[model samples]
Target: MSAYPSHPRATIGRYRNRGAYDFQAIHSVVNAAPVLHLSFIPSETDPFPTIIPLLGQMGSFANPDADPSSEPLDLYIHTHASTRLVKLVASQTEDGEKGLPVCASAALVDGYVLALTPFNHSCNYRSAVLHGYATPVTDEAERLYAMELITNGLIPERWGNSRVPPTKTELQTTGILKVTIESASGKVRAAGAANDKQDLENEGVIGKVWTGVVPLWQTLGEPVSNEHNRVPVPAYLDNWRKEANERGEEYAVETARKKY
Candidate 1:
C-alpha cells in the first residue's frame, strides 16, 4: 500500500529522524492515546484559533471490520451541539468543499528523562499529528455508528453492554464530526536519556548529576458502582482495567531501559 503523502505543512521540522508516516505506526499511537486535542480556525474573523480537548477515535464505518493495522482511518470526534465549535463549523463550512480544515493531535509520555545537563533533559514519548478536513455528521445512522465506535474505543464492546439504545433527546443534543485525514505523521522518542560524552567523562559532573528516566504510565483505578447498583462488576470492565494498567506500566518501564 502507498504511504500517506506528506504535505509541506505536515512534514516534521525538528528532529526529522523521529518522524514517521507509516499508517500502522501513526494509527497505533492515535488509538492508544486517551485524549486527543483538536484545533481549527472557527472563523475568518476570530483572532485566535479554537482548540478543544475531545474524546475521539479513528476508524471507517464504511468498512467497520477492516483491520486498523492496515487500512486507512478517519478520526471521529464526539461533541455537544451547543459548543462554539459546532456553531462555527455549521455556519462557515460550504456544502461541497472539504468541510473545515483542522488539525488533531495525540501523545503519550512514557517516561521522564533526566539528563546530565538541564538542556538535554527530555521525555520518552510517542505522538501523532493528523491534518484533515472535518465535517459535521448529518446522517442519522452514521452519527450513531460514530458514537458506538467512539464508545467502544473507550471500553471495548461498551455500547451493546450498556443501556440498549439512546433516546431521541439524548441523540439530538450530541454531535459528531468525521475528519478525513489528508496528511499525517507519527513521532517517537525512547530508550533513555542521551547525554553528552564530555559530560559523562567529567568525574565531577558524573558524581554530581543524577541522570536517568523515571518511567510513567496511566493506571486504571477500581470502578465504583453507584449506590443504586446491585450487580458485581462485569468481567469485561474488570479485565479491561487490569489489562490497561498492565500494558501502560509495561511500556513505561520498557522505554526507560538504558541504551548503552
Candidate 2:
C-alpha cells in the first residue's frame, strides 16, 4: 500500500488509515462505477455547486523524469470539444483577480450501517472525495489513449468488439481533462450505533428503535433484448446474467438492508 498523507481528524479505528494510492486501488474504484458526480464552481459570482455525471479512466503513465518510481496520475474524464464544461476549463486564465474553477472528484465505495445510539442513528457508508484543478490533456496521442482507457474501464473487453481506432474528425472534437489528486479523504462507518455502555445496558432488548446493519451492493441483472432484434445474446452478457441469478437472493437481502 502506498502511504497517503495523514490528516489529524480523518484517522478512525481499524478503518485502514492507509490505502494504496498506486494504480491498482485507484483503477478498481474508478472502474467499478459507470458514473460519478463531478463538481465545480466556476467563479466567485456563482455560489452554488454544479454537479455533472462524468465517465472516467484511471491508469499510470511513464513520467519523463529519470526517476524509476514515477508518480501515478488520476485521469478523471473527457468531453466533446464543444461542451460548455470544456470551454469553461480551456478559457480559464490566472489573471490574479479572475476566479479559477474548483473541481471535485468523488466516488462511493460501499453502504453498510444502521444504529440507535444517544440518538436514533441510521447512517452508513464508505466514500472518497478529491479536490483539485482540471488540466487539459493537449497531446493528441495521449487524448486518444485516454478515451480507450475510459472505454475499457467501463466494459473490460468492449474495445475488442467495438469500432477500430478513432478517426481524425473524432479526435479533433474531443477534450480530455486530467485532475491530479491534491488532497483526498475517505470515510467508513459500520455496525450498530456506538451508544454509551450504560445506555446499551438500560435499553437491553426492550428498545423500540430497530437497530442493525443492512448491506447494499450493486448487481448485474438479466439482459433484455428488443423484441424485433435477431442477434444472439453475447457470451459475456449471458454469463453475467446467469451469475446474477445464482446470487439473486443475496442481492435482494442487501438491497432490503439499504432501504432501512
Candidate 3:
C-alpha cells in the first residue's frame, strides 16, 4: 500500500504540512529509531496512562523479503513474559477481541535549531506514531523470527555471531507482542532556524545573537570487551559501527543546511 488509511486519532492537527502517512515514511522512522515508547491504559480506575520504553522492530514473518516502503508490516516488541503488558494482552485475547489497544511512538533528533528568540528555537526531528492492537504471538516460529529480526535490527549479524537456539526456559520466559497497526503517521522537520523578519532586520539583535543549527547525531563508541573475553572486536561489528557513524554524521550535517 502507498499509505495507511487516514483516521481521526492518527491525524496531525498542528503543522499538518510535516505529516506523512506513506508506508515508507512511517516504517522508516519506526525502524530507524533505537527505542520505541508504548502507551496504554493500565486500568479503568488508575486515572493515568502507562508508558514504557521498549526495543521494537517492524517486519513481516510471512514475507521475509518484503519491501517495507511499499508493503504493510507489523510491529514486534519483546519483553519478559511476566510483564504487565504481556499479561494484559493475554487477558484481552481470552475475551475474544483482537487484543489490547496501544499507541507506539518513536523519534530521532537530527539537529538543534537556534534562533534569535527562544520561541523560534526548535529541533530537526523525525517522529512516528502508531495505533494498533497488540496480541501475544503464540506461534513459536514467528516468535523466533521476531527475536532474530529485532536482534539484527540493533546490530547487523549479531544473532548468527552469538548463540544459536534459545533454551526452553529462555523461550518460555520471553514474551513477543505482535502489533497489528490500525493507523499510523510520521512527522519530520529537517531544516535550519527560522527567524522572523523583525528579528533579522534588527541590527542589534542580528549582530549580538548567533543563530544557526547545531547538528547532532548519536555516536557509537569503541567496543569495550568483557574481562573474561578473549576475542577482539569482530570485523562485522567494527565495519557496521564505522558505517553507521558516517551515515549519521552526514545526514545530520546535511539536514542542518536545509531551509525551513
Candidate 4:
C-alpha cells in the first residue's frame, strides 16, 4: 500500500475510513486526461471567476538537483506569457498580509457513474481535488524542463522528433507555473445500484424500465490519411486499426454514442 501526505479536508467519509491516499492514483487520473480547467480569483475588483484551459505535466516532487521525495509530490505546467490568469497570480507577494495567488480548487473527473437501485444505487467515479498555491518558474533551466514536461505530457514521442531544443529567447517569452498540491483528496464510488428486494419482485416493473450495466470505455480510431500525402500509413496507426477491428461493432457503437 502506497501512502501520501493528507490534508485535513482530504480524509475520507470518516477519518477512520482513510480512503486510498496513494500518489499514483492521483497522478494517473491527472495524466490520463488531456485538458484541465484552471480556476483562480483575479486580483482586480471584478466579481467574475477566471477559468482557463490548461495543459498539465505530472512528475514526482524533485528539487533543482532532481532528488525525488517520497512524502511530498509536485507538478508543473506552462501557459502563454500574456495570459491574464498568470498575471493575476504573479502579483501576490509572500508577506503575511499578501501572498502568491491561490487556486481555490483543482479537479479532474475521470468518468460518469450510473446508479440503478434506490438505496444502494450510485454512479461509479474517480476524482481528485487539490487546494494549493501556484509558483512561477523564473530560472532559465527550470523553464525549459517545464516546457519539456508539458510537451511530453501531450504525446510521449514529441521530444524525439526535434533535433534541436528551444532557444533561450523562446523560453523567456513563455510563462510557466508550478502548482504544489498542498492538500488533496481522492474519492471513488464503484458499486451497483441498490434496489429493494420488494421492488425487484414487483411484476412487469423491471421489464418496463431499462436496467443493466452499460460499461463505458475509451478507444482509439483509425487514422485517416491526408488527401495530399503520399507516404504509407505508419505501423503504429495500423496497429490501432487492427485493435479496433478485433473489437468490432460494440466498440464502434460506444464511440458513436460519445459523440452525441
Q: For residues 1-260, could you state the per-residue lDDT of candidate 1 as single tens digits?
A: 53466898878899898888888878888888889999998767879987899899988878988677778888999999888887766765665666788899999999999999999999889999999988888899889999999999889878999995899999999988888999998888877888899999999999999999999999888898899998999999989999999989888888799582
How much RMSD separates candidate 3 from the native structure? 0.8
How would you encode candidate 3's per-residue C-alpha lDDT over 1-260 as one tens digit per residue?
Answer: 68877899999999899898999999988988999999999898999999989999999999989899898899999899999999999999899999999999999999999999999999999999999999999899999999999999989999999987999999999999999999998999999999999999999999999999999998989999999999989999999999989999999999999888
Clash list (residue pairs), candidate 2: none
Superposed by TM-score, candidate 3 places the C-alpha of residue 67 at a distance from the truth, in angstroms, of: 0.4
TM-score of 4: 0.71
Ordered list by TM-score, greatest first? 3, 1, 4, 2
How far in Å is the alpha carbon of 104 misplaced in model 3? Answer: 0.3
Q: List all candidate RMSDs to the true structure.
A: 1.5, 5.7, 0.8, 6.0
Cα error, candidate 4, residue 147 (Å): 1.7
Per TM-score, the best of the predicted structures is 3
User: Could you tell me which residue pairs clash in candidate 1?
Assistant: none
lDDT of each: 0.86, 0.57, 0.93, 0.57
For candidate 2, lDDT tens digit of each residue in 1-260?
24234454333345464333443344444555557667777556978878888787655344423121234456548678777777677666333323234444445434444455535554454345555567677787777777877876666556666676878888889878776665545553433444445655666643765656554556666668899867777886666556644554454345435432
Error of 1 at 60 (Å): 0.2
Residue 41 lDDT in model 4?
Answer: 76
Candidate 2 has a TM-score of 0.71
Instruction: Show where candidate 2 strays beyond 4 Å.
Output: 1-27, 63-71, 93-101, 117-122, 190-195, 203-208, 226-230, 238-260
Give the clash count for each candidate. 0, 0, 0, 9
Cα error of candidate 2 at position 125, Å: 2.5
